[model samples]
Target chain A: MFVDLLFNLRAQGLVVGVGEWTGFLDAVGRGLATDLDGMYHLGRALLCRSESDFDGFDLAFAKTFQGMEIADDLREKLEEWLRDAKERTEGERVPHEFESMEDLLEAFRDRLEKQKERHDGGNHWVGTGGTSPFGNSGRAANGIRVGGSAGGRSAVATAMERRWEGYRGDRTLDLRELKVVLRLLRSLAHDGPMELDLPGTIDATCHNAGDIELVEKRERRNRLKLVLLMDAGGSMAPHAERVEKLFSAASQMKDTFKSFEAYSFHNCVYQWLYKDIEQLDRVATSEILAKLTPQHRIILVGDASMAPYELFSSYSWPSTTTDAGIDWLRRIKQRSPAAIWLNPDPQRFWQHPTVSAIGRIFPMFDLSVQGLKDGIKKLRVPH
Target chain B: MAEFAQFSGTDRYIADEALMASVNAALVLERPLLVKGEPGTGKTLLAHAVAETLGRPLYSWHVKSTTKAEEGLYTYDVVQRLNDSRFGDADVSNIRNYIKYGPVGLAFDSDEPVVLLIDEVDKADIEFPNDLLRELDEMAFTVRELEETVRAKQRPLVIITSNAEKELPDAFLRRCVFHFIDFPDRERMERIVHVHLPTLGPDLMKAALDRFFAFRKVAGLRKPPSTSELVDWLTVLVASGLDPASITEGDPFLGVLFKGEADLAAAVDKRRGRKSW
Candidate 1:
């Protein structure tokens, strides 16, 4: 619905992006989000979010209103109707049709616990791990571990093995081991400062009545904020969408990070990235980029397509400026070992004179597409 | 309402059942249903059925670039509030009572289910969804000055439509059931035509549909005409007393369905050259 609302609004002229929608949802799940007006947060959320992506969103919307006279008439009609509603609500309460989000979660948890108890009472358990890619399946495997605790080395290994088994994916596994995989794949990863789940620590302290709702409803506090600077133009065009998809995937997938912010940089990063990619002021943006921390998991999106001698050739992206995007990248990676480059340009192309030239500057940049998932894997869980 | 129900029976068609189920369930669950599909797939009709079935007055909010959340909700009428404010203690309540429930408010107040149709929610800014989520989750909201929660007893069934431009974030996807409506198949399209245009002869309908599919096959159309458009155009042809002998006259009405000038020309040329499409 979020996607639906997004496109629907876009059709009408309001244009929210996937990033904003995610942030809004993150805000809602954690219960920190607020309403701006009666414009309909729920309505927008339910109908506008799309899984196939932002492609053709506007075209579809324009189709729905082909002979729509109602669009014009309804605006004023809606305002009048709203007036009538508040008028009716003057003295009494007008309870929302939907339950409290907190209440809904409570009910959902209760139903889940009931199912868990019934399942646990049976021969098999809703145990351990499984590959819960989108986390849409309620991610049900909480507590029925195969003689292990929730956090630890064994848990980690069990998770990896479970994922590995599923990775082969030819054969299906029993229920118990599947949960192990789900927890491994989707659970948030944290290592410092706001580290909610230590890399390998297990604390068996909890009240008996406590449930695993929090396990599914994650707080953004554990997220490791990343600032991605992708390179566009040139050979990067073909892989632009692919690189962005990875960025999109990582944006929603990574629990190790709080939030991910992305920017596009050409040959150098002397300044800040424009929030809107269309507008970038060299002097001011450079100053802003300088202020951003190098601690971000700065994954570069461009296919180092510059001339082989380009970096040493002495001309930066726009040239003659005091900014070196490659240098900022090297500095950022030094602070966070997780930084990696994603290029859709094939590896065979990597040895091409142009790529070879860029490679001389940044030797360890992995040049593979399938390696995208792997690179992101390294960023969050650490090799 | 009758126009559309009959229109559904026209010579042209769209296939949208999975979307129907999702929308139905969302309403049953009292959760909003978000529908994303191509431009001509009938996203708005689902909202129409909801309003028809539930007996709730339909409130349509067409999102625009400048659309602000504040505008969708209640706006203050200072004179009304101030005038009522002095009437008495009851009048104080009246000040807050300057009710003109917006679509969101109508969903909250109407004793009957109000279908709040946000026809195209994608036009707003990236912050739009976040802005709407709270009012949706709360069903009841606190207008800053009210110092109290204005809760809705009646929850409106929210129907949002979109064409997927990009993948929505997981956070946004979490709030409701999402569905994508596909274009209808040949058999269904024929059936739809029969339903909307019962008076049309079967052979003529089939011929018209054959041409419709042939036209849809040509790539590069911005958006193929919707069932409603096809039906409207066919009606125009039939009412104009167009003959199978002179199909060339239907060329002007082709604009209603095919936006591509080249495709339209090709389709027209194809029809003009043949006695039957």
Candidate 2:
């Protein structure tokens, strides 16, 4: 029986070997695992090595023991929600029962507090598969869906959301146009004679070889420091490929700037900005502000389509004392007056309340070549 | 199995209920526990803490971007062998002496169960995790030079950590139990702070936490001070004999709390505004 299970796991792309099979059998024979749960623990211990494989093992385990098919439950639910959403609104603005934002938030908070069990269909409480003004699935004029894709309705807030990965990767940047725009904000300065200009020295030496002259060259460097803050996570996932292209292009322009630094945030510039995508050692935004001087040109890349609360609320889940996203943007702008917000969200959505709110503080532009040119022009003009 | 229960709640480490449960689950199942979290959140330390508490020898493999999966298993010194065959007096026929076992190999060959930590597995190339899948699952690998297969006498308790920089392949992820170590709450932070600075007075501790939380609350600070940073800041405070109340913007020791120049300027700006009032 264990061998069959191991075979099944192998068939499902799990790397189960002879040693793990023997170990599982040994544990079973020794009565280490008598029940299904015990066997699961034993099988998992012997056959798996990394967390990346847990989902696969879970599926294999379920299929072998419970005879249940593993399916994309979340995707299916999202598709169903989309269908329901499409049926509800046929090019008509569905009127909401709640009159104000405060009423909606109040009702949502109350239901969230009382919600103990997962409710599928209800007018109250946050849960999945419900018409309640909370949770995903079912229709509600204005509710905070806990999970699933954005149903393009009155979802005031989304809790524990995965970053969106919906943007097409084929959008290529015109490097010539990019370079022209990027050159406008150059702040070059001569910082004395720093290094040997070998090529220049060689050329000059050969020309004046008859005199055997020693020529000294002073080095002038681009004094401009760039802090590129990228939006990462659920909402930025779709724009990842394009953003990556832009990031690489910017980084490759080694001669354009004296120094270039990049950091990533989720929906907004929060307390922490990660230098790496792994969410490893993040430099505090305050620290970033501290490190960068007023002369530094800051470019923020993000699609500001997050729930307004994420921008306005002081407290978000997982963070007890998070300041509003706009406050962070203001502080960044305050320190680096030359900062520009490069929005990947289309020009049409620039009118979004959250987008407009952020735009009020920092001049917002599209992520396209034209937008880049416009943003550089704005930065060049003094406040 | 009962003895394993005693390894919980070591002075060096304080795991929450959920994390402890995951650890216990990994232990009972005899699978590698893959821990994911932000930097300085104790993903690496958890392995050390577990090894210390369990009294098992810990083997660590610090993975880098250039690290290949084969380096974790064993390395065959082909150059040395070739040199010996051509010029040296020593016999090159016996290749066992030249075969150096890596952390994973050593753990597998051990007589007893040991703890193996693959630190920052995400730093490696995309193929590294996938390459590890077979050896990790089987707990055995074949060394072609020796023409011998090395099998585990005892299954090593493996712990893998990822900073979430890159997503591990689904095939690789499915093989292990997973846990994410979130940032500690204030109460948990108090416990963590106390662990690092036992001699800290209540007044100083309170003052430090207040300042730390205040820095964290600043909206635009890129990277908030983590638990380790907090500890380092407190250590600096206790060492410098600096008064907690006098610790304001422009204080030389402000470098301990904030790493960025802009952050310091912003803090100083805020302080100046307050002073003007």
Candidate 3:
């Protein structure tokens, strides 16, 4: 029968009835009775309008709630549900297997705080995976999630398998592994007979009438070279790790894939990033292709998070073949049939000052990341 | 601005000496304070919430790609200026001083202490922020056309923010103290989410909170969704017509929850079969 806190705020002409008032109130209730972060949140809800204003509210909240004692006298149940403040999660990094983005964020934030606190102390700033490398290498990083494989139900496809699974739940084989299997299956395509080499071996095995034995044989051996160029930079850091896991999965599938090398780049693909224990940085793209055969497919992964200048500017990282960054990308597009810009950043951020400019230069742009079920399904490898 | 204030909480965190000190300093120091941190970290919420406690008018200038300084200050009324210039033989001096006020100007005109919210300062082009440093630092502007100076006299509380996408020019950031907002701890978040999303059952709160912490450990996330995002996620889950177990299985939102598509994709793959991996 009583009016709620939200109603009171609405009466005061300070709260909106639409959009997100309920969510705001829920957070404030949590903050009022819980932590400074909640208090900051309450301020953002009431005061800020966009991403930047949170700073003012935060400064204000920190000042106001520094010594204030929050009233936590809830009617019994709320107390037990509150996530305790002292339970740090750096050493005992728990696994979060969420089905949706919502659960991922809530669970992820919890891990972030412990590492954030560690970072705040001026220790372990450089990422060393989920385990905090400051003093705990044998343990999991406070906020990092270089998590183990989810399960075999997870796609064995290093890259495309995830896509295939997302597209068609039929895992006749891992899509990423499928790419390798396709190459392997193609490689086994030989011109010679299974148990015979040529005329002599054929005569010895089948004893065909001399001179009357005539057989036609075509030149064969699977030849498809794939060169995957991934952007390795700040923006690509997170997605790159996941993409790497996919690569690891594909590599482990002994029966499926042939050797497909991967390379990482920044403004331009720096050097090829390989799963090989010997980390090679071969600059000769042609030599690498020649050795693997031109038929190999080139798959690139990266968030083209470069300054706008990197695209059209003449002086921006010049290659021997092109004058500008855009020209260089065009050259690569010409050299390979399957060159794409696999942006790690979201599509919305694409309009962002940097991404749009880069997108303009790279025409064959696919904004999907390597992991979404649909994204992996879209990878076209010559099987 | 009204679009947001109506839905936001006006109390929870207010009237702290630190905020007042910062706000009062913005008024007195006449400098735009730069705030940096993760998105949804409440960078935008401070001004409105503080207004309730400060008992002042809060004016917000939402920064975007086309958010020029002129847009923030005053747009030229070409026809009006032309009409006034031609009709009734208005004096040149009178016409020159006839500029109207915008959000920045509104802050200058307020009688009470005002809080100016410069949301997502990082999103704008370099020039927008560059143009404001002098106005923010000196709290004064020159009207060369009128040969006059219109000083704020009482500068408003200034709050500028960047998600740290690109480092702001040093000249722009020199105006105020800097603070990095650390995301709330698990217990803190649990308490907050529990209070905000009361509709969710206890098991949900416990399970969601525990799982959330575990996630932050792996899946190298981009801008961990702020407390606000989680609150919405939980609220939607409870109201989503799905049972608790179903809610747990249906929560993949890397698309909505983070700025990186690939990161979420990777997270999904990392989570392949394991519900809690």
Candidate 4:
């Protein structure tokens, strides 16, 4: 019976197994989960391993148990059955004194609206006289269930709410996750000025029949230099949060890189790149290109989305000469062939003219956990 | 079969209905409960609560980066025996004297059911959990030197916690019941605070919660104040005998709540209307 639920969970991208399903069944059979609400919690506890799967679990649960609400519609069905029985018993005559139940309800509501003060003995107003149809404890037949006794039985309603949507993996890149991803860029090598190699000296002395020999080797250090070129302001504003998380994660890892530098650009890199996100402090793009070596791992963070003219047009606001924004981008990529563009925008939106053009220039990946991992893998390759 | 004790919750630990159900399910299934949550959400305290509620002995194994799964089962002190034999300090004939049981080994050796807390399991190497998969699943391990298989007298109620430093292996995760402790909502938070501070006045409680929640909303806080931090802050406030009316903006106990300098600045600045609140 729960095989459909298992398939549904798998369809929603949760890695559930037959073992987990059997365990869940065993738990339910042992009376661990007594009701539908209890089953929801029990299923989540048994099936899901991380908070990232919670949203998917909720979606799958809601889909599998859609319209299985028993408590809510019970009253309506019971009333319908009662009405049918009364009609058969009365033999083709109206059960209530009014033309229909709707008319009776309408008249009751109309009286309810007009009646102001309480009347103890009257049958007109919806008061406690045992005659009015609207009030509780009344003798009137086919009265509405007043003041509520029915409670909702739908467990799927809670699942449909999707409260854990914020915890979805693709939605946000938390600081810790970003740091973990960026830690992959660390490449430790022994390349600094030579220091005394004690082990090497001992091995050499032992091999040379006890004659003392000195050996010097370069010190081991993190030799990777990181250059971050980020798109800032204007259209890139929506992505500033994700880009900031990436930037902070990279910059905070003081031991991960030999040298780290970040510069911002608006939409496209023109003749200059701003030192700060405010775009106030500017450094010439040619100077940045001249300074960067191929050994440096350049990570470009941006949505890579802009008007076609912004990349191709020669006279696009910031640049006045014949050189367009695309020329500057190509120049940077040429200087550092190790560069990769990280688009905060989803992959589906990459078909945009400017995003694709930039994507073509540099291997692009979305700014997410998996994307960062893949990007680091690309960045790790020696040029 | 002996009936396993059910865990409703302890007086100090304010577990909601969902948490209770998850705990009960894990208990009934006799599987390790894998708890993932934000820092200060009482994931580690859960094992303690269960132990206290069930009146069982608690054994904890705090995992570190260099921690090995083998060490959790048994650590044979060969060096000690060698030193003793060399110095002629004690008898060295018995090899069993050198064999010391680790936390897991001790739990397996216990006469009664115990609650074994594997705190911060993700701190170890990626292969760490996989290495102990068989031992955890079967509740048994072999001491190769002794050539004896040590099995559990009673299946220990295992609770593993992760701050999610890294992704746990799928095979290891599949054998466990998982629960992610979400940040408590307003009502739950209130109950939690009252549980921790029974004597706290309602006025002060409202004021502290208001300030604490407001401070959390300030943007760019690298490490936001969580439930434990709130409890600590409230404890400090109550200890200082500060006026409830004085617990408005720019409370002097901001240092207790915010650990980072930038977070403190952001919170204080938000109150001053320098940034969007």
Candidate 5:
């Protein structure tokens, strides 16, 4: 019965395997869940592994059990009212007529459709700022409010709210997480002071009939020099925070890298790269190119979105720079072969003219956690 | 099936319904419960609470950046044996004496069920979790040098906590029950704080919570103070004999709330009603 729910979870990009599925089924069969609420909590606890998957789990749940809760909730409320009515004394209670179950359901469905139509009409439903009877906090007699007042909406509607969307991992990089992923960009080589090799000392002692024989090995240290050229100003302003996080994380890794340098430029790299984002201090691009070697890895951060003339024209990005932006890019790439481009723009929008042009120059990835992971993997290999 | 003790939370820990369900599920399923959340959100404290409520002995293994997976199982003390033979008056004939068991091994070797807390597992290297997959799955490990396998007499309940310094492997994550403890809402936060400080005045509690939530909403805070910090700050407030109304005038004891210099500056700027930092 839950096989469709499993498929739906997979369709929503959750990593739900047979092991998790069986465990979920096991929990269910053990009588842990007796109602919709219990089952919802059980499925999430057993199947979802991270906060990122919670949003997807809620989606899959709402899809599988869409309208089931409406009837369940109505029955529960009716039963509750019936019990309340039973508690009242015979003299205090007034005689009431009830509609047939079918007619009651028919009226409920019609009212639901009318509520949705009013929602679509605007200014009369949940989406509008004005007071509407079918929405929350609206003042209308005998009007049913939806959401925010708990037990008033169906379970499916609550699940569809997707409250855990902020915790999704696909968004922009967090600061500490950025530092963690950037730690993998190191190329470790053993070249420092020796430390005692405990395992080898034990092996030598055991082989020599419990005789003491000390063994020592050199410690390993990261030996890669990293250069970060980030884009600033103009269209890059939207992505300034993300790029700054990347730059700050990389620059702060003093112990992880042999040397690290960061320079900023507007749009694309021209003849000059600024020492800071303010663009007050500038240095010729050729001087940096001359100082760099083939071994040094370069990471270029930018949105790579601009007019077509910005890359090919000499004075488009700025009137002062003499060389074309594309020429300076090729010179840097030629000088340091191990370089990659990190675009803050989503991959779907990479069809832009300038982003595509830069894509041919350097392998590009998004400026997200997963994208940075992929970029770090590519950076580790000697390109 | 054996009857397992369920954790309904202790007097100190205020776990929500979902968290309770997760702990119970993990207990019945006999899988490790991997609890993750922001720092100071009681990720590590959950293990202590579980151990106390279940009436089981607790074993803790604090992970560092250089910690290896093998250290959790058994460590061969070759140097000690060599020293005993060379300069010390001790028997070196039996290798078993030198095979000291780590936290996991100690938990497995215990006669009764125990709670093993691997605190901050993400502080170790990326491959740390994958290395223990086999031993964690089977609850057994073979001491290769001794040519003997150590199996659990009673499967110990394992609880792992991570601050998400790094992403854990998918295979390792799939074997455990995961839960993220969100920052408690205002009502829940008041209850949590009240649990820590019962004698706190209502007016002071109201003023402090208002200031705390307002400070948390200020833009560009590098690190926000959590529940534990709030409790500490309020304790200081009561001890200093400060008036509840004066709490709104300026941030007293700001150091107790904000640990980061950048966050402190931003908070101060916001309080002063500055347009820019």
Candidate 6:
């Protein structure tokens, strides 16, 4: 059974080699996994090294076990819904009847208990289609979707969420506009002691007609330090291209500062911030704060579009240190008074509850040339 | 293949059941284990713990942004060979004398199943992982300069860690087992703390944990205190002889707890009114 699965995975362009096959057999022989889920996890652990291969591995695994031959059939149905959803905005409604998520959740819980069998297209009960407050493929703008691709972005939550596409660091960005704005944040100080001026030495040497001459003088280095905190994953996926451009531009400003640090976070700043894309090691927020002085400028980049609960609720993220994202933002603001937030979400969507909530704490600008100019100008002002 | 019993006694690591299962699978399968996690969550430590448990010699390759995949196999010293030929030195015609074994090459040439750690692999270029695919899969590589193929006498237990700085190719990922190390919970964190500081007093430990958890609960912090930070704070607390009861008070030691200027200000602001300082 496992061999057949491995063969199928290889056929599907997974590149399962002889070594991996032998290892899979060894795992099964050793009884590392007893059940199907365990086997799935074991297979995934042994087979998939990167997150990009996860989607392919899932399809191959499902096809081999569930005996589903038509892989494209489900995707085609999903694609059809997506196409229809994009074209038809008539069925789009937020169901303003419920005042709060709590009330909707309470009603949803009752319907779930009353539901006895699989339901499809009805006014009530947890199933596909209709104006029901639960399940996928329905006109319920606030429904909780289960077991389908997110055709429409109306769901409060999802069961089978799509994998987050990792950010590509090598992508090229037109930094001309960004560099112009970033230059505003530059603050050069001549007070600090400097080393030998190489360019000055060469000029002086040439002036002396090939005579051995050297110039030793202090050169002004940019005293300003900029800390860029970027948001990644999920909602920020749509704005990746723009964010990459910003990242490329910001990274190029290394020569503009005595010290520059960039870190990536998901949704909100929490216990850990990734220093790099691979997210192998993280420098604690506390450590970052300690390392940077109050004089340093902090720039936050994100769409700031998530459930309000993620910002204010105590149980937003499991096993995290923070009770509320707002508190963290406030803390950051208090430390670095010059901190500014750059929202990739359009100015129209800045009125979003979460975005507005974040805006209240930090001065925000859109992720554009003008927005970046305004943000840099704001950073120049003394706190 | 080694039995499951051989890989036992990994209790010092404090890994969860799922993580342990992944490690076991990787060991049994003889495939490389690719571990990903946020920093300071013990991703690299897993490799060390596994190697220690298996009683295997560990070979580490710390990759930087400029690191090339060829450096892990073998490097031909063309300049040195040319210099030797120019100097009329002995064995100038022998190409094997100029070939130096890199970490991967060393691992393949090992007589036993050594543990190979490729730390922070995402630091390298996009093509780095793909370049290692054939060698990793076949456990061998041909040195074109020497005109000889070197095969592994014993398959090394490869461990690759990524910071998620870059996305690796799907083909490279499919060749290894994957595991993600989540941030340890309070209970697990307590165990980890005890492991590091066994001599910590009960009262101080309780107070410290309380303060740590409370500080972590504060929002909008760009970087929250991690497990290692907590340990570092405790080390400082023990060294300073500060009272744990006064931890909530505006103590200067808050610097150890919150590293960022903003985080420190927030911590100070949260405790007592702004004018109290």
RMSD of each: 24.4, 19.3, 26.3, 9.3, 4.6, 18.6
Q: Of the pair 1 and 3, which is ahead by TM-score?
A: 1
* Local accuracy of candidate 3 as per-residue lDDT tens digits, A2-69: 13333433443332334334434443443331333333333343333323333333333333432231
Kindly indicate the candidate among 3 and 5 with the higher TM-score. Answer: 5
A1-383 in candidate 6: lDDT tens per residue? 67678877776566677766777777877788665555666776777654445555665676565422112233334336534443443455544767654455566656655554546788787667887866768887665564454443221121023232231111212355466457667787775676777756765654443455787777667888889999987888888878877888778878878788899887888767788855566867667766766788999999988888888876334345645777777878888889899988768899899999999888998887657767877899944
CA shift at A70, candidate 4, in angstroms?
4.7
Tens digits of lDDT, candidate 1, A1-383:
34554566566433455554554455345332122211122223343444322232332333333123123322233234434544544555323432433342343334333332212223222223342110112233321122222122221122223322222211222222222221222224343344344211221111111222122222334435566666755656666555555555555544544556666766444344544444364344545345455444556667766654444444455546454545554555556655666555656667766556445444334434325435556665644
Ranking by DockQ: 5, 4, 6, 2, 1, 3
- Predicted candidate 3 versus true structure: per-residue lDDT over B2-22, tens digit per residue: 212222334353233223433
Candidate 2 C-alpha lDDT tens digits along A1-383: 56567876887566776655665676566565545544565565556654334445665665565311112323334346545554544455433766544565566556545544445676776666667776767687665554545433211111112111111111224443355446655765777566777655654544443233455666777788887888877878888866775677678775678889988888888788889966686777788878777788888899887888988888442355658778888888888898898888778888788988988888888887657767877776637
TM-score of 3: 0.41
Each candidate: what lDDT? 0.50, 0.70, 0.48, 0.81, 0.81, 0.73
- Candidate 5 chain A: minimum summed lDDT over ten consecutive residues — where? A93-102
Error of 3 at A15 (Å): 42
As for model 6, its CA RMSD to the true structure in angstroms is 18.6
lDDT by residue (B190-212, candidate 4, tens digit) is 99999999999999999998988
Candidate 2 similarity to native, TM-score: 0.48
Candidates 1 and 2: which is better by TM-score? 2
Top DockQ prediction, candidate number: 5
Clashing pairs in 4: none
Model 4: per-residue Cα lDDT at residue B16: 71
For the predicted complex of model 3, DockQ is 0.01
CAPRI class assigned to model 1? incorrect
Alpha-carbon deviation at B54 in model 1, angstroms: 4.3
Provide the DockQ value for model 2.
0.07
Which segments of model 3 are wrong by more than 4 Å?
A1-383, B1-10, B14-31, B83-98, B198-201, B249-264, B274-277
Chain A agreement with the truth for model 1, given as TM-score: 0.39
